[model samples]
Target: MQKVEVSDRDWKHLLDLRDKVHVPGSPAGSNSNPCMSLYRPLAERTKPFVLAQVGQSLDGRVATPSGDARNVSGSDGIVHLHRCRALMDAVIVGVGTIISDNPSLSVRKVKGPNPIRVVIDCNGEIPADAKFLNDDGESVILIQADDVDRTINGTQAVKLPRRQSGLDVEDILGALRKLGLNSILVEGGRRTIARFLDAGVVDRLHVAVAPLIIGSGPNGICLPPVHSLSEAQRPKIDVYNIGTDVLFDCDFRHQYQQT
Candidate 1:
């Protein structure tokens, strides 16, 4: 990836933001700052790619203590995520995230073309009334592992062969490419992001760090042994400030190539 230098003042701003956002007291409190731990620069690539977009607290918690979405990030941060989504070709999430969050995964309140909604449901058990199934305008693609009933609620279903673990990342990417998706935004729930990072399939990462710490609960990403931070070499990052939040945009092209 190409390199661009950030001014010293901007770098200091990022460090300061990271320090202030991670409050050490209550789960619900103001003055909490979240920092996006992006792994690469955004303007250095020119390939069909994947962008991992996530929101996390100072302590790395992606959700509230009870898994509720009450205050993962403030209104500004949430809107920022939607804005990023508006620029991508598609928005993707894992099956677990779909079941838990029941998110529409669309770009709302942002002026841009609506990205296609992509769900990685290894199991063919998506709820019949899931919001994506009935969403207007945005195309929904459900990647499942079986040929189970596809006539449910007018949603498009793409079947993949079942494996003990889950959907194959390579096959999924290929399919997305076939759908004319040049860039994909992975709005994940930990496991999915970790899997892609571990597989070395991610091209870029866009993390929004809020100035608050959940202190505990689920993390933003979870990788296997091989993809552990200690094992995998660190990628480059380009930091940007949006509102009171810090955005860490990272890319990892030197270590691996898209197959």
Candidate 2:
């Protein structure tokens, strides 16, 4: 990958935002993360600049077994999520998110253009009357592994390769980038986030830690077991507080591509 220089002004803006949100209990104080040195300018690269967002409990649970996760991050976190969505070219999620939450996936709380809603549905399971497909002008994409003839009214079903784990992340990004989507925000329901992270295609990740702990629930990222701390992936992270929630901006590209 070609090295892209981050503009001084953009860097300053990010630093200002970081300083503005630094609170007593934020994780930005961590001095040991290896990914910090890789932070640089945000530029147009080979693929869309992808950022994954997750709002979970302190213990890292995103939702209960039954898929109920409303109000976990409070009002400020919701608005912040919307703001992130507004800044991206598209927002993606797995079919599980659509079935469980049936989220409209539009920009409501914030003032900005609504992103193209992309759903990774390898099995063609999303219902015809799903709420995500209800919007008329908004772009919605449903990706499947096979060339299934079934279709939803407003959803554009595209065929992509599927792996044992799920849909191929590389192919997904390539297709989206070809469509002129330069930036993508992945809003997830655990499995979808795990696939991207496991594939190592993720550039940035924003994890919002709410102030509560749900002892028994679905985790935010489900990875293979690692025996030691040294075996763990530690991206450079910047922490900020959005009301009662603490947001961790984890930069993965810098950690992985450092010379």
**Tens-place lDDT digits, model 2, residues 80-188:** 6876676677899998888888888888975556889999988888977787787674799888887555677767878886677667899999888878877888899
Q: Rate the local accuracy (lDDT) of all candidates.
A: 0.68, 0.73
lDDT of 1 by residue, 1-259 (tens): 2222233333333333322343333322211322222211221124677888788887778877677755577666676676556656788898788788888887675444577888887767777778777767688888887755554556678877766677788888888888778678889979888878877888877777789977888888776556444566466665666665666667676443223
TM-score of each: 0.76, 0.79
Which stretch of 10 consecutive residues in model 2 shows the poorest summed lDDT?
Answer: 33-42
lDDT of 1 at 245: 65
TM-score top scorer: 2
Name the weakest run of 10 consecutive residues (lDDT summed) in model 1: 36-45
